[model samples]
Target: MPEYRAPLADFEFLLHDWLNVSEHYAQIGKDDIDADLVNEIITQGARFAESEVAPINQIGDQQGCTLKDGKVTTAEGFPQAYQSYIENGWNAMLGSEEYGGQELPYSVAIPVHEMLVSANVSWRLVCGLTESAVLALEKHGSDELKETYLPNLISGEWTGTMNLTEPQAGSDLSLLTSKAEANDDGSYKISGTKIFISGGDHEWTDNIIHLVLARLPDAPAGVKGISLFLVPKMLPDANGEFTIENDLSVGSIEHKMGLHGCPTCVMNFDGAKGWLIGAPHSGLACMFTMMNDARFQVGLQGTGIAEASYQGALTYAKERLQSRAPQGVQQPDEKADAIIHLPDVRRMLLTQKALTEGSRALGLLYAKQVDIVRFGTEEEQAKAESIVAYLTPITKSFFTDMGQEVSQHGVQIFGGHGYIQEWGMEQLIRDSRITQLYEGTNGIQALDLISRKLVRDGGRMLQNTAALFSDMINAIQNEADKNMALEIQQQWLAGSESLMSGDAFDTASRAYDYMQFCAYSLLAICWLSMKDRAAQTGNDQLASSKAKTCDFYIKRLYPRALMHKAALGDSGEDLAALSLEDF
Candidate 1:
């Protein structure tokens, strides 16, 4: 069976050495988060994840969630584990201080979140969804709504959910038939059946705060008619406590391929009392504040799962006796050598490490950009937002794809046992499959990257992205491996220019390849940055490992970027010309 151990050293290297997050926090007026405090949080959070959360992963997968009498009961120990999480104040760490939270920077919260996900992704979604809900309510919720909802939600006494997908409205919100009628008491009667609601209903808490997207009676047609609402399962009465049950119930829970512990529900809100959030017909905008945050968090899901898979595979490789090393017997005393001595096993393990570490770095770096967008100086805020907007789709799609790839490699290293659940490699693969599907399918993310972000702005954001990398490379021009950095920057710029020059269909057709190209190139930047920092520290072991990994990435993985660039150059005409009739 697989076990989880948080990658504290890698996180410390990224947060303290590579990204200099402490300086970042100080710059953003977050003077409270010093290196010592940050290390303590990472250590304690890891302890909770490994001890309290990880043990429940396999149990949850087997037992799943039970739905009965319109109430969903999570897997055994889930509620207790969650209560522990709340008691430890994990949920309130990232929220606003105005709502009884610590208001730590995303840079800090993101690592803690990564640990939670790596330890137990199924359980992580419970609070993960609430974090997004908090973002939406804080950004768009009225003062009254915030006063009532924010305190409890931030304190983790109550949980939250985002209701967007219905049976008819899969990805298209225009087909949503959910209705909201204005009530005489200044509330709206939200009546709808929302499907695919993660953590939609659970007995873990007394109240579940739902952020629903519904249309007002006289609202405009299609998406323009949509409005955001805060609908709680149990409405609060005087003194802001759960005093009355709202008209909502769990219709059913999804028997999904994985994440069975989260209790994805088909929620039926029949005339549920809800308060409007933000202006009418501006629901999409409000919900996006949640979606963007969730999208990046979903990306972290991929990184976390991949890290766990890699660790499991590594442990197995070191223990499972196999064929002798190519050169000689690695373990003469034993009948067979450990698989870790094999070349192919090393390749698989190295790929997992490279991708997992790179993805973690990119995710946290993206989170730092989020911090800047929220609290940086005005000029810094504008620049960071532009950069983050350009990278969001890349973060979501690329990281998830890498997760899938790394998880697959994990299973492969285990050979036959990996296909079976007893070893736990299969569970990682099953759980990670949804990361690519939900939070917007990776294909859709690719299309969005091409049509909306890269091409729509006439390449302004893409140019800004190229410039951002170029500046980083320029900053390290005097370093030992500066030439390699310059070469990567030039190649990225060339690829960006070529993709932007294409037409809509041309760009769309090559969007997936282009996304991969950009993801790999950016990861190269991360690896090289770490390489330079390691070289400077005179830590021979760390420097050697970074150098070997950097060389492997460049020599093996980096060549794929060249192939993608070549693929991107195709007009996609031959591919497009083939019609459904051709099949």
Candidate 2:
């Protein structure tokens, strides 16, 4: 089985040294949440993930979830591991305190989540989806709904799922035909078949809260007509006891290419009992609350898988014997030296390390923005919201794309063994594949970044992001660090200018490249910040690692931005010129 050890030291460095999260906590009136408390939480979370969750990862993949007689059964050890996860209070880390949660900042919760995801992403999906549902309910659900459902969901006694897509509607929520009819009892009867629903049907929890999007009677046409509904697998009686089964059934679990441990179901809702979340004709808006949260978590999924794959590849490269070193025989006693001595092997390993660690830092930086949005003052919140909006698509797309590449690198380092199932490298590729496709495909993420985030705002958010990069650059005292930061920022700005100047079709054609350019730039800023901060702490080992990784990123990976920038000039005319029947 592929091994996973949580990157606890890196987590501590990012939170305490790099980001200075303790100061943010105090500024937000969380005076009691000191460094010790944060460290303890991270420590325990790591222990649980490493000990309980990691052991089940391979077995879970081997024995994927099964559906029998309309019921879904998860892999062996999943339920027990989840129970331990709940008992350990990991699920409620970010929930509201009023609902019996820890209410920890996203900055803290995210690292712990990365650990869980790295240990076992398929199992982590159940918890991650539930957290997104909690956020949606906390923000948009009515008071009655919150009082009725939030406690159980937060406590992990109940689980949750987000159902947005139907058979005909994938990314286009406007074409959805799901129906929600209002009843005299002030609830609605929801009837729809939601496909590709992650954690849709599982045995970890008795009642699964489904935040579904469906159109109401007499509602307006298109997205504005959709309404968000809180539908559960079991109905609650007058006493608020969930004893009666709702009119919902699992059509079947998807036989997916990866993430087999997670049960992605074809859910059939036959007039299931549900309550309106937000006002009618505002379902898309309400669901966005969940979708955005899910998007960020999906980004973490990418980072987690990348970390896992990197660790596996690095271990294999060190122990596996291959051709002798180019200069001479480093190991005279053996037939050949370890593959790690090879220059090409080192190149792949360093690329994986730089990209994975850079993605991790970028994710944490994004999480800090989320914390500011939630707890900062009004002006701070406004600025942070803009940063959050700008970074969302980049985080989701870039991290997942990095995860896919890193996993592939792991397979390559393993050679033929990577393709075989026994080495466990192939599973990482299979599992990371979906991160690019779901939570909006990486392509859709690019379009959203260019059209909605970059273009619609008239470049105000881009300026705000630039200001942030400038702050990081100015803080670095070292000339080399400052130079690296400046180079990436210049590349990013040039790409942005190219994107802003073109016509709609031309800009849209280059959106993916522009997003990639922005991603690399943001990651560079993150790397520079980590290196500068580590130097200040006088931690030679940490500082050296950070500085070397940052150097590798700038010299090696940042050139990809140049390629993407050049592609931005294409205007997509060639793409549009091709006729449908040309093939």
- Predicted model with the maximum TM-score: 2
Clashes of 2: 0
lDDT of 1: 0.89
| Per-candidate TM-score against the hidden true structure | 0.98, 0.98
Q: In model 1, which regions exceed 4 Å deviation? A: 238-240, 477-480
At residue 220, candidate 1 shows an lDDT of 89
User: What C-alpha lDDT do the candidate models reach, one value each?
Assistant: 0.89, 0.90
Q: In model 2, what are the clashing residue pairs, if there are any?
A: none
Model 1 residue 352 CA deviation (Å) reads 0.5
Query: Which pairs of residues collide in model 1?
Result: none
User: Per model, how many backbone clashes are there?
Assistant: 0, 0
Residues 1-583, model 2: lDDT tens digits: 6778889899999888887888989988787899999999999888998999988898889999999998899999999999988988888989999999988899889989999989999999989999999999999999999998999999999999999989999988899999999999999999989999999998898999999999898988889899999998988778978999999999999999999999999999999999999888988888888888899999899999999999999999999999899978988999999999998998999999999989988888889889888888999889889989998999999999999999999999999999999888899889999999898999999999998888878787888878877887888888977887887788787678656766778778888888888887788788887888888888899989988988888789888877877787777898789899974
On residues 1-583, what C-alpha lDDT tens digit does candidate 1 reach at each position? 7878899988888888778888988899987789999999999999999999999989899999988888889898999999999999999988899989988888888889999999889999989999899999999988988888899999999999999999989878999889999999899999999999999888889889999999999988999999999998887778766889999888888989989778999999999999999999999999999998899989999999999999999999999998789979989999999999999999999999889888898888888888998889999888888889889999999989999999999999999999998888998888999999887999989888888887777777787777767666665634656788878878887777766666778878998988888899999987887787777666788878888888888888988888988888788798789789996
